[model samples]
Structure formats: structure tokens, C-alpha cells
Target: MKVVLLQDVAGHGKKGDVVNVSDGYARNVLIAKKWGLEATPKNLNDLKLRTKNEAKLAAEHLAAAREMAEAMKSWKVETAIKTGENGKVFGSVSSREIADEVKKQYDQDLDKKKIILEEPIRSLGMHEIKVKLHPQVTAILRVHVGEA
Candidate 1:
């Protein structure tokens, strides 16, 4: 049976790809879950239109990500964490705290999942953090950790 995938299917094909699948897969799995539709003449045409619309939306999203990346490139966020006399933080800073601070400062609500820290900030110093805007769009941000 032939089907048009509505989303990426592992080991088979990606969204918008028309593929020949087993009858069981088409009837029991894909169709039942609304992950795909049977490839009829009208369905294929509709899938093409849907795919085109999705591509346009994806391009727009990519453009917006790029713009946000450029803006974030100039960002340097300062954080004050309680530290000891030896300059070690009592508690390490997490990505959620930094994401919240970013939102507080710039009014940009970034996903905590998109922030990447190689290691927790445990000392008072300047550091660099990476923000994953998209699979390809990334920005390095400057962070200054001060003792509070």
C-alpha cells in the first residue's frame, strides 16, 4: 500500500514523502495514528499542497531564527550567584535560571532546552554559552558570573 507520511518516520521516510508501505503498516499503524494517509489521487494532490505550505512556514521560521541569532550574538548577560571566599559558587547555575534571566532582561522568552552549557558555572568569572536557535543556527553569548 502507498501512503503519504505526515511526519518523519524512522527507517522509512520523512514527512511529505510518499512511500510504499505494507498493508498492515498503512492500515494498523500509520493510518490509525493519523501519521499518514492512503495515497489516493486526491490525497496525493492535497499532500503536495500541504507540503508546499509547510515548506513556506519552515523557511519563515528559519529566517526568524537567524534574526534572533544575530540579535543574541550581541548579548552579554550578568549573573550573581552566592559564592564563598574561595570564589566557588555555593550552588551551580542551571540553564533554566539563565533562560529566566534572559527573559527578564531582554523580554525574549527562550526555551531552556535550547540553552547549552558545557559545564555548570561554579566560579565567578566570564564565560561563553551557546544558544541553539535551530539545527544550523547557533549563537555564542557572553556571560559574567559575579559573587553575591
Candidate 2:
């Protein structure tokens, strides 16, 4: 029996794939568990339409990410914090702080986890930070720290 997989199954095919399996297995395991559907004409056509829509959405996301990456390259975030006499910041600046600052200054939302800071900002100076906007896009942002 031929079936269209709704989700991945170990030792078998992935979602959206059509595979032939024993009729008993298809009826008892796949259809009973709602993990797949019979490869009828209607189900196959539905899968085709769904795949097309998903491709279009993915392309739109990639374009948006590219535009954001270009804009981020020329942008800088300025922040001030309390400092000691030796120019060391009283506390460290975290990725959450940077993400909030970006939103406040540029009106752009960013995930804190995407702000790749190998270490927290602990000194007063200009620093470069890497932001992963997408799997294929990375942006560098300038951060300037000054004493408050």
C-alpha cells in the first residue's frame, strides 16, 4: 500500500514522502496512529499545494532577513552604565540589555539569543557584536559603551 507520511518515522521516510509499505502495516500502524494518509488523488494534491505555499513563505522570510542584515551593518547601539574609577563597568552588559537597546533605539525586535556575545561587555569602549538573523545571514553591530 502507498501512503503519504504526515511525520517522520524512524527506519522509514520523512513527512510528505510517499512510500510503499505492507497493507497491514499501513492500516494498523500508520493510519491508526494518524501518522500518514492513504496516497489518494485528493491527499496527493493537497500535499502538492502545501509544499508550494511553504516554499513561498520560506522565500519571503529569506528576503526579509537579507534586508535586515544590510541595515544592521551600518547601525550602532549606544549604552551607558555606572563605572568605577579604573574605567571598568560596575556590572556587565548582557545580550538581553543589547536586545532591549536595539528595540528602543531602532524600533526593531531581536531575540537575545541571536545576539552572539562571547562575553559580556565589561569595559568602556567600542565593541563589535555578531547577530545571527538567519541561518544564511549574519550581521555585525557596533556597540559603544560609556560611563554614566
Candidate 3:
């Protein structure tokens, strides 16, 4: 029996893929679980239209992410940390703090996970940070650390 997968199935096929399986398996495992549908003419047409719509949405989202990355490259984030003599901070700055500053400066929300920090910043100076905006896009963050 031929089936159209509505979602990805590990070790089998991905969403929108048409695969062949035993009649009993399709009926019991896939159809009964609402994971796939029988590959009828109408179902095939629906899958085609769905995939086209998804592709269009993905393209638009990618374009927006690219614009955000470009804007972020030239941006600066200023942070005031508690410092002792010789411009040394009492504590380090984490990715979460960086994410909050990005939002405060540019009004753009960023996930803390997207900020790639090797470790917390412990010194006082200007440092460059790496931010992953998308799988295909990246941004450089300029951090200016000063005494509070």
C-alpha cells in the first residue's frame, strides 16, 4: 500500500514523502495513528500544495533573518559592570545578560542559546561576540564593557 507521510518518521521517510508499506502495516501503524494517509489522488494533490506553501514561508523567513543579521553586525551593546581598580569586573558577563542587552538596545529579542559565548567575560575591554541568527546567517556583536 502507498502512503503519504504527514510528518517525519525515523528510519522510514520524511514529511510529504510517498512510501510503500504492507497493507496491514499502513492501516494499523500509520493510518490508525494519524501519522500518514493513504496515497489517493486527492491526498497527493494536497501534499503538493502544502509543500509549496511551506517552501514560500521558509524563503520569506530566511530573508527576514538575513536583514536582522546585517543590522546586528554594526550594532554596539554597552554594559556597566561592577569594577575594582585597574578595570577588572567582580563577576563575569553571561550570554543571558548579552541577550537582554540586545533587546534593550535594538528591541530585537534573541534567544540566549543563539549567543555563542565560549565562556563568561571576566575582564573589562571591548570584545567581539558571535551570534547565530539562523543556520545560514550569523552576526558579530560588539560589547563595550565599562565600570559602573
Question: TM-score per candidate, in order?
Answer: 0.81, 0.94, 0.93
Model 3 per-residue lDDT tens digits across residues 106-144: 899999999999999888889999988888888898998
| Weakest ten-residue segment in model 2 by summed lDDT | 80-89
Task: Kindly report which residue stretches of model 2 are placed more than 4 angstroms away from their true locations once superposed.
Answer: none
Cα distance off (Å), candidate 2, residue 82 = 1.6
Candidate achieving the largest TM-score = 2
Over 1-148, each residue of candidate 2 has an lDDT whose tens digit, in order, gives 9999999988779999999999999999999999999999999999999999999998998899999999988888999889887776699889999999999999999999999998999888899999998888898999998889
> What lDDT does model 3 reach?
0.90
Best by lDDT: 2
Tens-place lDDT digits, model 1, residues 1-148: 9999999989889988989989998999999999999999999999878878988999998999999989987888888899777665799888888998898888998998998987778877888899999887988877888887
Error of 1 at 48 (Å): 0.7
Quick one: ranking by TM-score, best first? Answer: 2, 3, 1
